[model samples]
Target: MRGRFSQAWSDVLRGSAFPHEGQAFLEQVFSADVFRPRPDHGGREERFALTYERLRHINDRVREAGSTVPLVQDRERLFPLLAWSAVADPALFYAMFLHHCMTTGAVLEFGAGREDLADVLEELAATERVGALLMTELGHGNSNASVRTVAEYDADREEFVLRTPEPAAVKFPPAVAAEGVPRLAVVLAQLVVDGAECGEFCFLVPLRDADGPLPGVGVRPLQPSPWLPLDGAVVSFDGVRIPYRFWLRDNAVLTADGGFTDPFGSPAIRARRTLSLIRFAWEAAVVGLAATAGASAAVAVRHAHRRRTGGRFAAGRPVIRYRNQQRALFGALSGAYVARLVAAATAGPEAPALTPRSVRTTFLMKVVTDRIAERVSARARTASGALGFLAANRFLDYQGFAHSLNAAAADNQMLLLDGAQALLAGTAYTPPADEAPAAGDRDLLDPATWETLAAVRERILHQELADGLRKATGSGLAPFDAWNGLYDLAERLAETHAARLVLGTVREAVREVAGSDPVTGPEAAGILRDLLALHALEELAGHDGWYLAEGLLDADEVRGIPALLDRLCERLEPYAEELAEALGVPYPLVGAPIAGEDYVGGLAGTAPSSGTA
Candidate 1:
């Protein structure tokens, strides 16, 4: 049981040395008493205090360890721990909040040509200062281009006066709030120079010092949210003044004569460029959601292996052996794999920067991962029965994470629609000449077959969408009304495109494993291939109607997907533990006592139960 798993685990460890080291360090620190939350606390305030203290200790330890601060220098190592931290305590995970600051600062230095701010960024990173991004407002939400917060330039004073003109202009959802911990913030405000609205830009404003809020800054903590443990609040500026040099003039510049000049012709273009800082949040969200899905699946699978139900068998079989159980739990396991692989591919070092293509990719991947994590968490919860509802299992926490992720960075629906618009405006898909195996003629397990099926499905969805839009417009409907009428179709197009992308990614991963060292490669590839098949088949099973309507599959072939999924599940059952372990989910992060090997005995507080047979 351990041979293939051990080999694959070793391969992962060897492939990324930093994550191994980082995991070790995290396990050590997380084991400390100071890091644990006091769940028995009677009130929300007490719980919040304990959580806050634990977070502070963790931050102190991170600083002491000299890990990547402000900006991630080595994501391969730090990302794993970040993922684990998100699972363990999402509140503590919020403490590592310098990435956007670093990104905004970098954009200013490179894109805005504010080269002089480079040293400031380095100092912020080195000092490990907590930096908040104040962009989202009560009125605008994620529509940063229309924010009412203004940063008007003062020529003689050579400073920018930040003001929230109305109640709606107050920046909400800032993690710092009244905590007074975040000493600085990259405030996104409309750049007004000489009475001209130049557009949105980032300015490094001192939010607080050791003594507390700056002269004209007010931080009012928002009503507590039951889901996210982090403190969030509305930050209002009452004529807060900062030096002109604090402006992150990435695509725009302030002239000496109190004039603004930008390469982009319009304020809207510059505002869009400035809002690209959200990419960091999107990447972090992808990694965090993948980890959440992996951990949820691990807990569900472990519980399934331990829990038993009596039936026609002599004693009883593990719940995982049940077809329904396998369908619910194993499907989630496949989703976890898909999310992790897609996140890894999207967030790699060489990934493109802040372009329209990169932004769309990030948005699509983030939405996909969030949706997968949510579905997997729900399935995991259902599979675990009563055990999943217990606080000790952290299923509820995982559920909260799913909701928070969907709402974080930007609303998931909004992001999906944004991606849809980009897709529609770009090139239309050209369907291949029936590359997929006809009905019963293809090998369901073949990677090529799965790739072709996914690609063809995506193409079909795209073509159908294009035809629908053309017809809608041709019928004399306004463009916006036509799009609004086809909102559901647009969403389906985005989902289909995402599905195709993830399937392609998994196919490549399987091929890589197969082509590696002959010793472990074959075993790893075989297991991954089954997972890939299950993923593809499950998807096809869900969308069988679409396939049938598009003439991509016959009724018999569509009906066969369920049986194929069951066969795949059975072949992979013996290696379920190994598959979950390969996801690199730390054992302690499982956060459920039922995941233990002797959960049956432990639950009874006695000898092992014969039912576990």
Candidate 2:
């Protein structure tokens, strides 16, 4: 079994067409041994301290090797690195996120060589100064426009006085917690000048000197959790003052005469522009969740291939050969693959700027990817049985991380509701007519068939929602009441739109792989085609009710989906290990001791001496 798995792994590595630089970087990361977790010290505080210490060491190694330069400077390498580091460790991944995504982006976008900030951008890039983004408040969450934290202009001193009026105004979870004092923070506060509300803007506040928190600033660490090992804190400000120039005034400015001016006519527009920094966090969440899901799938497949159990046909056979086990593990593998493609396409460089459409796309991507991660991790854990329940296996850790990803930067349900609103407003997506395939094709294996199915479903759902909303409002229902009546339809429409986007992305990826390399193109395409079909069938099966109610498909077609999925899974069984390997999670990062080669033999050696007793 080990020999066969190794051969399949080799085939996958040789068959897939990864970018040259990404492949080389992945090789370096695996060879460098920088991502190993520290041994447990049997206490929460001790474990947290050890995890953070390891995180700093990993950061130093990453910096020394310049592994993150590509991520900061080039868009092409960002997704690959994001995918790889996410499988390493959550604490380390968050640290890298602070350094590359939060700190570097904040400095480059807002603080480059500004005299008021004392060239903080250069310091941030060189790691001489560390930074955090303090945007979400305990009371307001990410509703920046309504946050209680205030930055009032002091006209006499030409400074901004920052204050947290209530306990709810405190910022919690500022990325790099418990590591040390952060030198700077991009604070989101309601800007007030002369008792008039100007708007919400980010002010660069100095949080700490070499010794401790700056005067008037307070930082208290939250209780430790083994699930997410960051030093999360509640940070408050009491009349903390900084020069007016420290305000990130790209969208609005404070005049010397104590007047506020913004090129954008409305304060709402300015606030929207100011909040574009959330895109980076969204991308991080998407990529990290996808990577975690992929890693979980890898571990599950490895365990399934090694562990044997009694079944109807045999006394002892590999668990992976069972139909139920194959469906669970392969289904997870497919979801992970789809998630990776979605993350890459949504956050890729060519994606539009931070417009409403792009924002909606990012939100949809987050919701879809996070849901996929949750489902995949759960399925993978169950497939691994007893071994999966152990913390040392890391599946449980992945599951927690997946749940946290859904709730982290933004809540998944809220994001789905926001997408629903977009649909109601007719600002949501509509597939181009030319791209839709001809109808009545039962070949679920064809990419065009799946594309057409997704597009048609989205169109039908959107029209249904539009009609229902119009009638409810026309009948004198209140605006909120009308929306409430159609809330379920609206949510379904958003999900359909996301499914269409995922199918389109998967089709494009299959084409890219098939066209890129002559030696491995056909082999890779075959595997991806099977995975794609499984993904489409599974989605269709879940939405069978919608299809039947809309007359999109006859009952026969709906009933045949299970059989089709089974066939596809059977065809994919031989290549399950290969497909998991193609996801690029390093073997060492699969932390389950049972997932290793000699688990059975090792357990035998450690068994108790029963005869003497």
Candidate 3:
């Protein structure tokens, strides 16, 4: 099994064109059942679904090409600007959930014990097969608001009988991954005990393991398209008994005695824990989008700068030089780094329990990530002009997948509202008047740590202020520049949050390490402080005039920000490669093809493109 990403990446850089099967398959993927209001040709639905199918197909090809890097790591190549189209057009998003279920390998991980599916998934994982998580039924998506599929505990038989009682309850629209005869899927259903609903959990079901379907696991395509294969449809369960351990066990668990035990402390804690896994995985995907777009911008801008303009239908010399193009590519460039910087700041392995404010802060970074991918990718297509539309070059397809991924990954507004609810929710959960630390508890508060947390709050407030001012001021600055300013502010706020978490976590790690040098620790601490100050200052500079006029800071502080920001950018710039290294695979989630060793030639003699062409 190819485990290393750098080697796996070489499979990413091959020709960006769709496969012949893929082109023939597209009409089925882009069908009316899938596209809805969007057109089948050249429209938003066509572009968005095409992008997802192509990128997913690329991952398949790359896996076949023997790239060790995970498909998630090579996201920059798979999901591009088309993600923007997904948010605007419903059709793109419609296929997104199904795409994720297929591409992500959900079924194989959770539904492993069902003999046929398990064998198929093991082979796929060993050989780089695309996988999907199939928990969301036609009856429910995020909310298990109501589920009807039953997996009855059969103690005597030593197996659970999985059954779908009604058509509405069946797993409808399992989508394209199922269309090509998939490798694996995690099927979600409720556990029944004498007609009472115990809870919901995922059962890993392998569809097309190494050979074919597991017995009793029926599979079929839903909507067909002219452009891509999006056969997300339904499947049924007729007393299909899977082994007990096939449950994901992330939240609710089945006891040996047949009772259910949720050991994550409380029902609320358990719920949050489950959501945490989902949020973390999806957030990782969001970050992947940023990394992908940033890498694409680096290459496209460099290429644009080199290419001469003014041929028939040509975008003039050096597209990035155009303010509008700069607005798109450079704006995204800043955003990806900013989001990365923020994620690093807010989330350390041992960070404090999220204050309501902290949860909102982290979740918001995810929102910005999703939104920025959508916004910038669309702009990238427009910036590329006709070239952006060509399936061979594949900017359009890349953009489409990004669009759908962002749109369906989770609704941004819903998530933002949820985060806000969680943040403000603390008041209801804890008595507001007694929330502050008690006397003598002051010693428990690490001074710098508290200051960092407080600073995070203040910094976010400042960004909110900046965004509001930008729209209110209507300064007529270019939209890209305006957004860049807003993102810089958001970026720093993100970093401030990340820095606090990392530093706060270091204290715990140091205590565990025992003899670690104190001097080195503080120096490292300084590095984190520098990170917060740097990105935050970049944000502050964008609206320095507003700050000065508003009396938020004196002229010296106002004037000093640019110098301070430049200083920080330069300092961090030197450490950028190290930063990338420190981030590990988490940083590569954005899906750009180039980040892996495959594109840059870590191993001699392998082709660099995504392998399928």
- Structural similarity to truth (TM-score) of each candidate: 0.89, 0.89, 0.53
Q: What's the true lDDT of residue 359 in model 2?
A: 88
- TM-score attained by model 3: 0.53
Give the winner by TM-score: 1
1 versus 2: better lDDT goes to: 1
Name the runs in model 3 displaced over 4 angstroms: 1-124, 127-130, 166-168, 172-182, 208-220, 224-231, 250-276, 307-325, 339-363, 427-613
What digit string (tens of lDDT, one per residue) describes model 3 on residues 488-575?
4444444444334434433332232222344444544344344444433444465567545655446776666555555545454433
Q: State the lDDT of candidate 2 residue by residue for 467-574, as single tens digits.
A: 898899899999899988787888888888888878887887777767656766766676788886877788888888977786777788888888888898899998
Better model by TM-score, 2 or 3?
A: 2
* Full-model lDDT for every candidate: 0.72, 0.72, 0.45
Best by lDDT: 1
User: Candidate 1 or 3, higher TM-score?
Assistant: 1
lDDT of 1 by residue, 20-74 (tens): 5565777876777764433344465555455556555655566677765333545
Misplaced by over 4 Å in model 1 are 9-22, 37-70, 97-123, 126-128, 178-180, 210-212, 310-316, 351-354, 427-436, 474-476, 598-613
